[model samples]
Target: MPVSFLSAEQRSRYGVFNAVPDIAQLGAFFHLDADDRRRAMAANGARNRLGWSLQLGTARFLNCFLDDPEDVPAAVVDYVAEQLGLQAADLKGYGEKEARWAHQEQIRTGYGYTAFAGEQWFALACWLYKRAWTTNERPIVLFDLATHRLVEAKILLPGVTTLERLIAALRERVAARQHALMATAPSPNQAAVLENLVKVEEGRRVSRLDRLRKSPTDVSSTGLVKALDRHVELRGLGAAGWDLSAVPPGKIAALARFAHAARAQAVDELAGDRKLATLVAFAATMAPQSADEAIEVFDLAVGDLLRTSAFKATKERMRTLKDLDTAAIVLREVWLKIRSVAEIPDGGIRAALDEMDLAAIHAAADVIGDIAREPDEDFQEELLDRYATIRRFLPKLLKHLDFDAGAAETPGQGVRRGHEVLQALDFLKAIERRRTDIDPSEVPADLLSSAWHRRVFPKRGELAGTFNKSAYTVAAVERLRESLRRHEVFVPGLRKWGDPTAGLLKGAEWERARPRICDELNLSPEPGTDVERWAATLDFVPPARRRPVRRRRRPQRLGTPGQRRDRQGPPGAHRPGPPE
Candidate 1:
C-alpha cells in the first residue's frame, strides 16, 4: 500500500504551488472579500495581518496550508496585498514568533474547517472504498477525485503519501472481495470443470484453455467449422450462466484481459481464488466473443466460395469462346450453301448435298448442343460444385446460431414476420429436421432472388417441380450473411453482429430528449418547418447563377513513341536537355 504509483514530480508538487497562479485561478480561489479583509485587519500588526491573509488564501487555493505559511507565489502575495492595502514585504517576519501557529488554529475554527483526523479520516476512507468497489477507475483518477472531495467537505487535505496509501489499500481490498465473490459463484461440479481448463490432460501437450484461446489461421470451410466447434465448447462449459451479477463489469473485464494475456501455466500457479476467478472470467468473456468470431469466419468462407466459383465460371467461359467462334463459322458456311441450292432446280439439291462436307456440319451441331446445354449465364450452377463444402458448416451454423429481426410489432412474432432471411432460416431448419422429404410449396419464394429462383426450380424435366435443395440452402445462407452485414437480422448474445439499433435513443427516451436534440442541432421542433427551410435553401440557387465546373486537362506526352522516360531517377529526370 505504498505510494509507488505516483511519480516523484507529482508527490513533490502536492499541497504546494508548483507555478504562478493563472488569472482565473487567482480570481476564483485567492480573491478575499470584506469579511476576509476584516479578519486579517483584526490581527494586531502589519506582519500578522499579511501573514493571516496569506494563510487564508493558501488554504482556499491549495486546500491545505504549507508548513511555512509565507511560502507562496509573488503573484498571490501581491494580489492579496493590493486588496488589503498592505505591502507584500510585511510578510518577512510573519512566522518568526508563536503568533503564526496561533493564527492557524483561529483560521481553522473561524472558517468552519476541520482537521483531517478521527471522524473525518474514517468518512474519507469509506468514500474511497465505495468508489473503488463500484468502479475500475485508475489510481491517479481516484486520487484527484479524493482531493476534490476533501476540499468540498471542508476537511484539511492529508499528506500525499497518506492519501495514496489509502487508495492503494482500498483498491486491494475491493479486488480481494471481487475475487472471493466470483470464486464461490460456481458449484463444486462446475468448479471442477473450470479447474480442468488449466490442467494438461494425458496425450495432449497443451491445456484445454490454451487450445481454445488459439484462433484459426486458415479461413477455409474447415477453419470455419473449427471455429464453430470452439464456440460450442466454450458455451457448453456454462461459464456465461454463472451468478456474477454482483461483480462490476470493469472487474470482469480486467480479469478477462489478464487471463487472455497470461500463459496457462502462469494462471495455474496463481492462488486458488485468483485462479478460479481468472478461469471464470475467461470462459464468460470468450463465450460471446467466440460466437462473433465463428460468424465472421463463416462470412469469409462463404465469400471465398462465391469468389472461387465466379473465377471458375470465368475460366470455363473463356475456354468455350474458341469453340463457339469456330462453330459459328462452320454453320454460316453451310447455311449459305443451302441457300444457293434452294434457288437452283429440284435436281440441284441432290448435287449440293453430295458436294457439302456433311460430317463437318454434323460435328459442329453436336458441339453447339453440348455448349448450349449448360448456359454460361447460369453462375449458380458453378456454386453448386461446392455444395459439399457449404454443407460441412451450414447445418451447424443454422443449428447453433439463432437469428432475430431485432425489432417487431409484437413479441414472439418477429421470427415469422421479420426479415425474409429469417423466414428462409426457418424453412432450412425444418428441412434439416426432416432430412429426406421436402415439400416444394414450403419454399420461401419471396426470399429467393430471380437468379436463385431459376436455379431452385427448373422449367422442365424431373427437377422442374422438385426444387434443388442444395441451391436453396446455399441461397438462404448467403442471404443470411448479407442480411447480417446489413443489420437486417441479428444474432443473439453477440455485440459485433448484434442489433445495430440497440444503442439508439427510442421510445420515451427519444421523446423526452427531442426538443433539446432539435435545439442543439439547430432545427425546428416541428419537422415540417425544418423541411421547409431546407427546401427554401435548395430553391434559392438558380440554374443560371450556378457555375460550371472546370476540368483539369491531361498533359500531352513529350517522349517519342516506344521510348520510355525514367521518372524515378530524380525530380526533373523526365525533362529534356536544353539543346541536345
Candidate 2:
C-alpha cells in the first residue's frame, strides 16, 4: 500500500521518517542547511543527501524508534553515518539524523536510544514485555525501548542469545513465579509459608550478588534487588498477587520451591489439627504427589470435617436444647447436612436423628416436602428410601410427644405433618408405578386416604366448594368421575378398581361417570291469537322474501272508455304489465 493511502491518524500510529505533505517532503529526510548540504555532496556526491536519509528511513520502517534520546547506542549512530558516506565530523552538528533524534527526545522525554544496552538485553526485554503485556491486565515488568535500562542492569542476560533459549528461560521463570503467586493467598497456616518464601528468596539473592561481586567486571546488584522486591511483595497477603514471571530466574525459582514446601507443611499442620485429622489421615493414605493433589486432599478433608462437626453439634443441640424453637433450628441444620454430606456408616447419624424432639421432626417435614416437590431424578431411589425411613419413624415420634391432630391450638403443626404424610404417600405411589411387578395392594391405602382426607382433599375442597356448584367445583368433580369411569390411577394408592384396599365405594364407578343429557324441550309457542298475530307480523317473516301487491284496473272516461273498450279487447287477447 502507498504511504499516502494511510490516513493522518494511521500515519501517527506508526513511527515514520517523515509525516507531512508526503513521505518525501518530510524535513527530517533532507539536509538541514547549506553546511549539511555541502557535507552530503562531499561524502556521496548526492544532491538530495540520500545516504543517511535512506538508512534512517529504512530503520524507521523497521520500527526502531526508542523513547529515550540517549538509549540509541553510539554504534548505531556512527554506523548510519558511515553507511551514508559522511565523515563523522562533517555530519556532527548539521545531520538530519541528529536533528530527528533531538526533536524526538525534546518531545517524548527519552527518544534517543531505541534499543537496550545490547541486542541480548533488547531481545530479553522485548520477550518479557510482550508476554507480560498480553497475558495480564497490567504488565509488572515495566520497560520502555527508548530508555536503555528501565530495570536494573543485572536483570539483563550476559550475552547475545538465540530467541528460542531466551523464550524458554522466560517461560520457565514466569511459570515458577506464577506458581509462587498461586500460594500468595493467606491461609490458616499461611504465616509459616510466607516466612519460608522470604528466607529462601533472600538466600538466593545473596548467593547471586556474591557471584556478581566476584566477577571480572563491576556488576550492579540494583537489578537483582529490584527483582527480589517484586517477588517478595507477592508473598505478602495484602499484595495484589500480580504475575511475577518477569522476575529473574534464580529468585523466582527459589521462591517457587520454598512456596511449595511451605504449602506442604501447612497442609500437614492442618491435617494434624483435631478437627481435620480424621480426613487428613484418609487423604495421606491416598499418597497424593502434586500440589493440586494435596490441595484436593485438604478440600475433601475440610469438607468432611465440617460436615461431621455440624452433624455432632446439631445432634448435641437437639438432645440438650429445651426450647422447641431452638431444637427445630438445629434439626433443620442437621437435615441439610444429611442431604449434602456423604453418609457415615456409624450409627451415630441415626442416633443423632433419634435425639431430635418431636417438634424438631415436625419442622423437618417441611424440608422433606420440598424434596418431594422437586425430586432429584439422579437419586430418586435414595430419596424414596429416605422418605420411607422418615415416614416409618415419624408416627412413633409424634405419638411419643402426644401430638393432637384435632387440636386448633397447633393447627399449623397438624397441617405441616399432614402435608409430609401426603408427600410420602405420593412418593411411594410414584415408585410403585415405576415397577410394574409391584402389586398396587402393597401401597399403604389407609395412609394415602388419610393424607387425602386430612391434607390434600381439604385444600382442594376449599377451591372446589363443599356445595360443588362453582365452575371449579364442577370441573374437579367431573375430572374425578372421568378417572373413576376409566379405572385410572387417579387417587394415590387406588391404582386398580379390583384392588381390595383401594378404599373406593362399590358403586362409585357408576355414580361418578358423567351423566348423559340427551333430552331436549319443545320451545315453540302454543298456537293462539297473540301468537298467530306475532307470527303474521313482518318481524316474524323471513327477511329475504316480500309480499306482492296486485294493481286494480280503473275504467276510463266516455271517450276514453270507448278507446279503453278497444284496448280492453286487445288486452283480453294480450296485455302486459310492468316487469316484476
Candidate 3:
C-alpha cells in the first residue's frame, strides 16, 4: 500500500533529473575515470558505450537507472558524451537495442549493486524502525537519511511510493509501541483522570488540559501562585511517578508538542492509546517546565516589588526635599545664634534659643522628625512591606519544588556545599510546617547576612530575642532568589533553574575524555600547567615595557562652520588666522 505523505514536488523530483546539473555535480556524478573509460571503450559502438556509461554514472548518482534511459537532461547527455569522447547524438539509438537491458544487468553485477528485496529489504525495514522509534525526525528527514543509507550500501533505490509507504508504516508502528507503553503506565482510575483532563467540567468554559496549557499571563504574585497551582495539578496526575523511562525523551517531547498545539476536541478524537499517551506526555513534560516557570515568575515578581518600593522611596524623598532644605536653614540659624553666646551662660542654650524664632525652631524640629528616615537607609525595610505578596507564593513554591545543593565534592563524605542557602531553605520549610508557632531562636542566624541580622534579631527593644516573622521570611526568600540565580541552590527537576553541574562530564567518563579535551583546548593534562600558562599570559607585558595610553584631545571649534581656523599645520609655523 502506497502512502500519500510525500508532497507533489517531492514525488515529481524523485528518481529523475529535474534540473540541469551544476559544474560540481556534473564533475562528481558524470565524469568517467580510467576504469570507467576502459569499460566504455570495450562496448561495440559509440551508442552502446555512451548508454552503458550513462547507466553506470546514473546508478552512482541517482542510485537508480531511469526506465526511459534516454529521458535525461541535455547537459547530462552532453557531459557524459564528452567524457566518453562521443557526440551527444550517439545516445539516440542507445536504448532501441537489446544490449541496453543487458548492460543494466552487467552494471548491477559488475559494480556489486543489489536489488532492494529479500534480506536487503528486511534489513532496511529494521534499520528504519529503529530510527523511527528513537527520534522525532520529520518524515522527509527520515526519507532523505534512508535514501542516503541505501545509496551507501549499494542498494538500488526502490520506487518513491514504495519507500514512502515503508516510512509511514514504520512510523505508525513506533507510535503504536509508544502509545502502548504509556497507556499501560497508568491504572484504570488514573486512566479515568487522563480522560477527565480533556472533558470540560460543569461551570467551566475550557477543559482542564486547556487551562494547564496556558502559561502565566502576568508576572505577579497572583500569576506565580496560579502557575504553581497548575504545576501541582499536573503532579497530582502521577505522570511524574509513571515509569516512562522506557520511552525516548524525543518521543515524549514530540507527543507533548502535539498535545499542546492540538485542541481538546482534536486530542479527544484520537484512539484510546494515543489520547492517553498524549495527555501523559503533556503532563510529564509540563510538570517540571511549570515548576521552572513558577520559580521564574516568583523571581520577576520579587524584582517588581523591589523596583516599586525603590521608586516610591525616591518619590517620597523628592516630595520632602523642599521641607528638608527649610529645616536645614532653620537649624543653621539656631546654631549660629548659640555660637554667638561664646560660653554657656546661667540659662545655658536657653538664652540663645529665646533670642531666636522659637516658632521656626519648633517647625524645623517637626520637619526633621518627618524626614528622619532616609530613602537609601535600608531597602530591605521596603521589601518587608511587601512580605504579604511573597507570602502568597513562597510557601507553596518551597513546598512543591525540591531544591538541592548539587553533588558532594568528596565521595562518601556526603557533605554538599552551599550549606548556608540549603540550611536556610530547610529552615523556611520548617517554618512552613510550624506556621504560627515558628520559633525565632531556631532561625539560622549564620545564614542571615549582616543586614538581615538586626531585622531578624533586634537588640535593646521589646522585639529582642524574637525575630520578626515577616522579616525572616522575606530575608530567606531574598537569599534563596540570589542563590538560585547564582546556581548555588537549584531545583531538582527543572531544566532552566536545575543543577548547573548536571551536564558536566564526571566519574570515569571525565577521565576517558580528559586527554582529548585537554589537547583540543591546547592545554596540558596537569591543572598546574594550565594555571601557570594563564598566569604567564597575564604577566606577558613587563612593567618597564608597558607604555601608558596617550589621551587624544578634542579639536576646538573656532567661530562658525564657514569661519573655522585651520589647526592642521605645525604648531607655530602656519596657523591659519580667523576668517575675515
Candidate 4:
C-alpha cells in the first residue's frame, strides 16, 4: 500500500508515521458503516436527523466529584452529544472512555470538535512538541488534587513495580532461606512495600502536573499563553528601553541583538527568582504524548519569565555563564540519570546504562550532553581524547563479557544439569513408586548407563574462570569420573588429552589421577570402581605393570588401610604384606 490512504484500524491508531490508525475515520467505518466499506457514512440527510445532547472536553479525563468550566465549550458538548447520543451536560461524572465517546458522537452528528473549539493535537503537532523530551521522563501519574492520593495518573512511573532487579540482587538472601519455605520470603515484600510508599509520596506533584498537560484546552489556553506572554512583552519593552551599547550591527544583526536582549530580560524576570517554577512543576507531571511540548513551553515560559524579572533577581538567579565548572558537573549528573532509564532509546541514553557499554556509554553521553560546558581548551581536548579511548575499549570489554557469559550458560550446561538432578529425582520417584517390591534385575541397566552416569564436570571457577583466583575447577572428564566413582564402575574411556597412555601412570595410581588429568583433557569418563581416582591416575601411571600374587588374608573390613592404598600401582608400592 502507498500508506497515503488509511486502513480502518490505521486511522483509529492516530499513530502518525508509526502506523497508528486515524480514530476519526476508523470510528465512522466501524459504527456508521455497518463494518463494511459501502455501508459507511453515506451523507444521509434523513438519518442525520437523529439528534443528541452532547458534552465534550479534552481526551484527558477529570475527577468525578469536581465541577467547573460552566460555559462548557458548547460546540464540544454539542458535537460529543451527536456522536454519543447524549448531551454535553449528560457526560459529566464520566471517565476518559466517556469523554472519547462524546467526542466521536460529535464527529458523527456534526463537524468534529476542531471545527468549533480547537484540535486536540494542535500544540503537539507543532514546534512546541519538542518539549516532550522532559515530560516523557515524568510518568503521566495521577494524584488526588485534593487529598494528594492516587486519583488518576500513578504517583510513580511504575506506581507498581515488580522489583526484578532488587530481587535478583538479593540472591544471597534467597539462598540463606533455602531451608525455609519460599512462601515466607520477607525481604522482597518489605522492600517493595516501602519503596512504593516512598515513590507515591515523592511523586504526587509530578502526577498532578501530568494530568494538567493531558488537557489540550488547558495547555494551549490563551489564558496560559497570555500569562506567559505578559512576561515576554514586558521584557521586550525593557530591551527597547536599554542602551544598545557599542556592538557593531547591520539591520538583521541589530534585530538579532535586540531579540537576545529582550529574551534575556524576560528570562531574567521569570526564571531569575523561580517565577515560572510553577510551570516547571506542571511540565514535570507529563504524559509521554504531551510532556515534550509541555516542557518546551515550560522552558520558553521560564526563560521569558526570568529575563523580565527584576534586575537584581536576574543577576542572582541566572548566574554568569563564566561560572559553569560546577554547573557542568551538575548538568552531567542530571543528564545521566534522566537519559539512562527513559524510553527514548537515544545514544546519550545508551551510554548511561551499564548493559550497553561502560566506556562508550560514558563517552557518548558526554559528547551528546557536553555542548557548552568546557571553558579550558586543554581540558576539552583531553576529555574528547579520553572519550575516544573509552569508546573503543568499552565495546571490546562488553563484547568479551557477553561472549564469555553466553558460553558459560549454554543449553549444553542445562542438559548436563538436567541429566544429573532430574535423573536422580526421577529415579527416586520411580523407586518410591515401586518400593513395595525391589529387585536389582527389575531396575533396567539403561538407568545406570544413562547420560547422568556418562557425563561428568570438573570443579567450577578453577577451570572456566581465571586460574589463580579461582576456588574450583570444572571439566567434563572430572564430572563423569565422579559420577562413575559414585556408582563404583570400572574406569575405561579415561584418556590424557584423548590419547591412551600419554602420561606416566598406567594402573591403580593412574586410575586415581585420571579425573584430575581428565579435567585438563575435557574427555568423558570410563565407568569403573574408584573411577574418579582410576581415570585421574591413568594419565599419571608409571610404565611398569605387575601381576597379582596369592597371599594370606587378615579378616578384612571395607575401611582397612590395605584397601586405602593404590591397588593397581607397583605391587609392593604400599605394602601391608608380601606382594599379592
Candidate 5:
C-alpha cells in the first residue's frame, strides 16, 4: 500500500539524496501522535511508515524532542545525532537516501544512529512513552532498528541486526532489571541491587559517550539532553536504595517527574521512605475530604506509577494493597467506637504506641498506662474509665496486636468474656419476646431460675421488666456481637463456647441440628444455637422454585396406502390427501 503522507511520487517522496526536507517533514509526523493528535508520534521513518499505515495515524511515536529551543527538541536531535555519530548540523534536514545512507554507514560502523536518543533503535520506545504518558502502560521492550539488535528500547525493532548473542544478553539484562522492580516496596535489601546496576551500566554509558566523543560531539543539545536522563535514572535508582548520592538534583527532578509512573525499583525505593511520607501527607491534605477523595488519591498515585519506568507494580500487587488498606481502615473505626465511651476510653493505650497524629478521642495506650500508675486513685480511676471506654475495641485491638508475627498469640479471653455480654443481650431479647408472648400464670419457673437470668438479666414476674444492672451488660453484649461478626477465633475452651445457651429453651432444631446449622451460618452452636441471630439469616436463603410438569403424549401412526386399501377392502375406502 502507498504510504499515507509519503507522496511516493519521488519528487515529494524522500529517498536517499536531498532527503533533508523529507526528514523535516517526517519530523512533523513524529510530533503528532496522529493527524488528530490523539495518537502518538512515530520515532523513525520506516517505523512511522508502517505504524501510520498498519496501526493507522493513531499509532503515535514518542516525541523525541527533549524540552529545549531547537527545532527537533535538543534531546531528540542529539539522540539522533549520537545514534549516527553525526552532528546536528549534518542532520538539519535529511533526504530519505541521506538518512538511509547515514543509517547504513552507522550499521557498517558497529552502531546505529538516530537524531533522538530517547528513541534510538525503534519507534516503540517513543510509542511506549506516549502510551504511558497518555494511557499509562508499562515500559515496553521492542527491537531497535538503528542498533541492529535488541536494545533497551520499546517500539519497533530496527531491521538491521538479528544477532542471537546480542539479543540474549540484552534480554537477560532487561529481564533481570524488570524482575527486581516487580518486588513490593523496597527495603534495605534493595541497596545492593541498586549498587550492582550502577556498576553494570557504567561501561555501557561509557561506550555510548565514547562514540559521541570520537565524532567530535560538542557541548551540544544532545549531550545535555542525555545528561538529563542519566541524572533522572540515577536518582530513581538511588531512591530505590541504589544510592546515586553522587548524582545531581537536575536528574533527581527528572526522575521525580516520572515518579508517578509505573513502579520502578529506583523510584519505589525513593518513594517508600521519606518521599512516600511527604507525598502521602501532601496528597491527603490537598485531596477533597469527601468519601471519593481517598479513591482519587489512589487513582492518581497508581497512574503516576504506570507512566514511569523506574519500577513495575503487577495487577496482583495492586489487589493485595487494596485489601490491606481496607483492613487498616476498619480497624481504625473499631478503635474509635471503643474510645467514645466516657467511662471507658478505648484508644488511649494504642494511641501512645502509635505516636501518630490521631483524632482527639484517641490517646496513646502508653499514656493510659502512665495514668494508671498515678498515686491519685481518682486520676487512676478516670484513666481506667477511659480504658473501659475502649472495651468494645479490646478484641479487635488484641487481634491487631497479634498480627505482628513476632508477638506471641494473645488468646482473646478478655474479649471472649465479652461474648456472654451479647448472650445477655440475647437473653434480654428472649425475655422481652417471651414476656410479650406468654402469660405470668403460664411462665416456666425454670426460666426465672436460669443462671443467665440471675445476674445480667433479672427475671421479672413473668418477663424480666426491671432491667438487670451488671458490670457486663452493654459492653459485654456489644463486644461479643462484634467478635461473632468479625469471625475472630477466641479461646477454644468452654469460655469460647460463649456463655452457655443452656439458660434458654432451645428451638426445635437447635437440639439436634444446631451445630451443623451454626457452622453454615457462622454462628455458635455446640448444642444450642442463637435462634434470634439465625432469624436474620432465614430470609437470606435463596428462594426455591418448582419446575413445570411436562406430560408425555402417546404417538399414533397412519397406515400405508396398501394396508389401508386391504383393510377398507376397496380404493374408495382410502382418504383423500389434505387440500393445499
Candidate 6:
C-alpha cells in the first residue's frame, strides 16, 4: 500500500526529528509531494472537511509554539484545541503522540501559520528564504503553488535591504579589500584568500546586476549599461566581460570596449613593469590587426613611467660601454647603430635574456623570419650578419639566465627561448658548413650537449653531472644501471662531477668506461665477492667447466630366467678372469 500518513513504526524509521539527517543539525526536514500531502491528511483521521480544517489549525498553533514558545499565548493553544473539537479534559490527556500528530499535520499541509494574513505570510516566507540563502552558496527559490507565482526574495544585510543597496555595499567592500591588499603586501596565501573574498563579493554584485538586467520593467537599458560599464571599470576587468549569452549582439561590443579601457588604465598605472610588458605582448598577439595601436600605448606608458635621470645615472655608473675603453662618443654612435638594428649590446644582453624578457627579441625574430624569405642577395647577406652576431652572443648569454623561484612561467619562457636559440645556432652552423668543406654532424658534441643540458635542467648553481647534486649508493647505482642497460639508454651520471660516489655509465662509452669508473670508486663489479673483478678485466677468468657425475646401478634380483642366467655367468666369469 502507498504510504498515506507516517505510522508510529514508520516515523521511528524515517522521521527528521529523530536524528535530523545531519550530525550538525543543519537544514533538515521531511518533504512530501502534493498527492502524498493529500493522502497524509486523509490518513490522519481527517475524513471530513471540518476534520481537515481542525487538523490544519492544530498544526499552525503547534508550529507557532515551536518557532517561538514564549511568544505564543496559552489562549491561542486552547482556541486551536477547541477548533480540533478537543475539550479541556481531552487537552489534559494530550501527550507525545498528539504532539507528533500536530507536527506531522504541519508537514502534510506545508503551513507554519494558518491564521497569518496574506501579506504577513508572504513576508514570513521571504524571511525564511533569506535565512536559507545567506547560510550557503546555494540558490534559494520562493514559489507559491496555489497562486502559481514566484516571489523575488533578497537577504537583508545590515542597513542594506534592497538589491541596489546590497550591490553598493559589496562594491565598497571590494574597493576596501583591494586597497588593503595593495597597502599590506601579504603572503601569497593571505593575498589569495583576500582576492577570493573580493571575487565572492564581486560575484554577488554581478548576480544582482544580471537579475536587474533581465527585469527591464523597472530599470532602463541605458541605466543598466551605464552601471555595468562603471562596475567593469572599478573591477579593472579591461576588455573582458563574461556571461554575455543573454546580452544583445548590439550591446556586447560596447560592454567589451568599456572593460578594455580598464586594461588601458592598467598600462598607465603599471608602466615599465615587466609583468605589464608581458601583458602588452599578449594583447598584441590577440589583437594583431590593432597591434600597432596597442604597442604604441605600451611604449608611451613605459616612457612616461621611466625616469630620465635614471638613464643618465646608469650611463655614469657604467662609465664606458666598451671593455677596451674606446672613446665615449664613438661608443654612443655604435650604440645608436646597434639600437637601429634592434640588437642589445653585449653588456645588457645577459640581463635581458636572463630575465626571460623576450618581448624585444620576439619582434626582432618575427621580422627576421619574415624578411629572410626574400630572394634578394643583399638582404640575405645583411640577415646572415645580424643572425651571426645574435647567435654568437646568445650561447654565452643564456648560461646565466635566472629561473623563477617556484612553479612559474620561468621554465616555460626559458624553454621557448632555448628552442629559438637552437634554431639560430643551427642556421649559422648550416651557413658555416656550406661555406667550408665541413660536415654538419662534425659540430663539437660535448660543448653542444653541455649547453643544451644546462639550458633545460631546472636546478642551477649545483655541480654538473649528478641527479640534482645528490650521490647514489653502490646498490642503488647498480639497480639504476641495470634498468638503463635493459632499456638501452645511458644518461648523465648520478654523482656530482667531482664527488667521490658511485657512478652511472652513459652513452656509447658505457661498455668501455664501466670498469674504469668501478676501479676509481673502489667498488667490485661482481655481485658477491671482491676477488672476482669485472668481466672485461684482462686477468679475469671464466668459471671452471664441470662434467656430470655418473650414478652406480642397483644389482638385479635373480628371479627371472635372464637374471638367473646372469648370476650363473658371473660365477663362470670369476673363473675365466682367474685364467686371464
Best by TM-score: 3
Superposed on all Cα atoms, model 2 deviates from the true structure by an RMSD in Å of 33.8
Once fitted onto the true fold, the runs of candidate 3 whose alpha carbons sit more than 4 angstroms away are 82-85, 326-370, 373-376, 407-418, 432-441, 447-449, 516-524, 528-580
Cand. 6 TM to true fold: 0.19
3 versus 5: better lDDT goes to? 3
> Clashing pairs in model 1?
none
Alpha carbon lDDT of residue 348, candidate 3? Answer: 62
**Residue-wise lDDT of candidate 1 within 1-580, one digit each (tens)?**
3546899999998999999999999998888898998899999898899899889888888888888888889999999989888899988967676898888888899998888998887898999999998888999999999999999988989999889998998888888898899998888888899889999999999999999887766798889889989999999888867888999988998998888889999999988588999988988888888989998898888888889888987788789988977987999998888888798677477678788889998999888876653432556778888889988988888888888986554576544334688888888777776757566787887777777887788777677777788888888877888888887788876889987877789989998999999999998877699788888998896667768899999977777644533443555567655795
In model 6, the runs with Cα more than 4 Å from the true position are: 1-105, 108-175, 186-388, 391-445, 449-580
Q: Global lDDT for candidate 4?
A: 0.31
lDDT of candidate 5 over 1-580, digit per residue (tens): 0112112363221112123334554455334322422221222643322222212111122212111113233444444444333455553333322333433333223222233235342354444333323221221222223232222332223222232233334434433333243332344544444324313254364322122112112232233233333323333433333322332323233333443332334433443333442222212212111112222222233233223312222333344565555545655765665456434544365545355455432443333333222232211122223333334323332322111111123376333333333334444344532444433343222222233333334464553644433322323333433444343423221122222343454668557776676688887754345675677687577878988999989766479878866765765666656799
Q: What C-alpha lDDT does candidate 3 achieve relative to the native structure?
A: 0.85
lDDT of 5 at 347: 39
Better of 3 and 6 by lDDT: 3
TM-scores of all predicted structures: 0.79, 0.20, 0.82, 0.12, 0.19, 0.19
Q: Is candidate 2 or candidate 4 better by TM-score?
A: 2
C-alpha lDDT of candidate 5 relative to the true structure = 0.34
- In candidate 4, which residue ranges exceed 4 Å CA deviation? 1-415, 441-580
Question: Which of 1 and 6 is the better model by TM-score?
Answer: 1
Candidate 3 scores a C-alpha RMSD against the true structure in Å of 6.9
How well is each residue in 1-580 modelled by candidate 4, as lDDT tens digits?
0212324553332311232224563343223222221222232321221111112122122211112323234544454345544445554443333333443444434422222112322322231222221122111111111112222221111111111222222322322222132112224443233123212246364322222323333322243353333323222222322222221112223222222333323322432212222222212122122322322343343333223333434353345443344545555665667665675655455455554345644554554354343232212122222232223322222221111011113364443332442233233335533436343334322323222222211234443222210101112212223433343222121221122333468679889998888778765556554567766888786777887988989865565566555463575575466666
List runs of model 2 lying over 4 Å from the truth: 1-39, 42-50, 64-115, 118-167, 181-457, 460-580
Tens digit of lDDT per residue, candidate 6, span 211-282?
A: 212312212223333333332322332212222233232222322333243443332343222222223222
What is the C-alpha local distance difference test score of each model?
0.85, 0.35, 0.85, 0.31, 0.34, 0.33
